[model samples]
Target: RFNQFFSFFSRIDTLGLNNFIDPRGYVQIQQIMENMTINRLEIRVDSLYMDLQIQILGLCRKNNIRNVVITVNPGGMIDQFRNKLCTESEFGVTLDVCERIGNVEGAYFGQWRRFWNEMDVYLRKKGIKMQMNLCNDNGFDHDGYARCGVRSHIRCERMDRQNMGVIRPISLSRGFLPK
Candidate 1:
């Protein structure tokens, strides 16, 4: 059934999937990859779990995804992740600064400052740019947005001033990519 659904759109590219999927979700993803045709794929997950990492990498390989972007929380080893998933082409591993910030001492954002600092260095070393989609993590402060591994930071500091100019200069819309 999964295969049949995706088979309808053989020309589709630029696939995106969520993180923390169940075992059945993995199976469905596998089937979708096998059935559909994808090039640019973005796998957004909470943390870089080895299990999901391996699964996503495997699917990308099998489908021959060209521009693969894996956005996970900032903690995983750069070398290890790059070796496991990245290739010579356009591959990026961005640090999503915060998730829910649940249980401050236990979550990734617990060591938020540390995570961003490390991720900045890692991304710089790999020459992979980062993009932040600030979904407003429950009244989290925006002051740290610039420091938290975001390539395009949203600044609301000078709202009162005249002529702030374009917020995000670039166009994120996928106009050129295949449907």
Candidate 2:
């Protein structure tokens, strides 16, 4: 089913794909991706599949993908953020920085901050460029901000129910992708 689905598109400049799939599907997906001309590939990393993130990174490197944006779910572990596996290409990260705030939120926020900081430092050492964004966990703040100083700028829209995807091109004026 997956191979046939991919056979329909020969080259995709930008695409969004769900990463909440079985590990076995990754190799197949990677093989398909390698044959396409993908300028950018965006994936939302579910916490349940944290281990698969490394494999996805490997796939990106092997395929020589132009740009990759991985939106990591909240409470997700950074143990998969290893340098050796990510030595080839640079990628971006869209993290759920803070969606709710309370006593419990504080602890979670702290944990997320530490996680982001550690990943940030790790990526910096690896010379990998990253783009950071805070998604609603649902929607934007009342002020239409993703968070303090953060604005919702870019989003990848799924084209169909089958997880076929495309990026809704928008202004990247705010310099979200850090240097």
TM-score against truth, every candidate: 0.48, 0.52
Which residue window of length 10 is worst by lDDT in model 1?
Answer: 170-179
Each model's lDDT comes to 0.43, 0.44
lDDT of 1 by residue, 44-129 (tens): 56565556656766666666654555444444323344345433323322222223223333224324445545644555465544
Model 2 whole-model lDDT (C-alpha atoms): 0.44
Per-residue lDDT of 89 in model 2: 40
Report the error of model 2 at residue 145, Å: 5.0
lDDT of 1 at 121: 55
lDDT of 2 by residue, 1-179 (tens): 76778778777765666555576667767876667666565554444344465666666666556555444434443444444323434343222222122233422322554665575566656655322333433333334333332322222221122322322222122322211
The positional error of residue 127 in candidate 1, measured at the CA in angstroms, is 13
Error of 1 at 59 (Å): 0.8
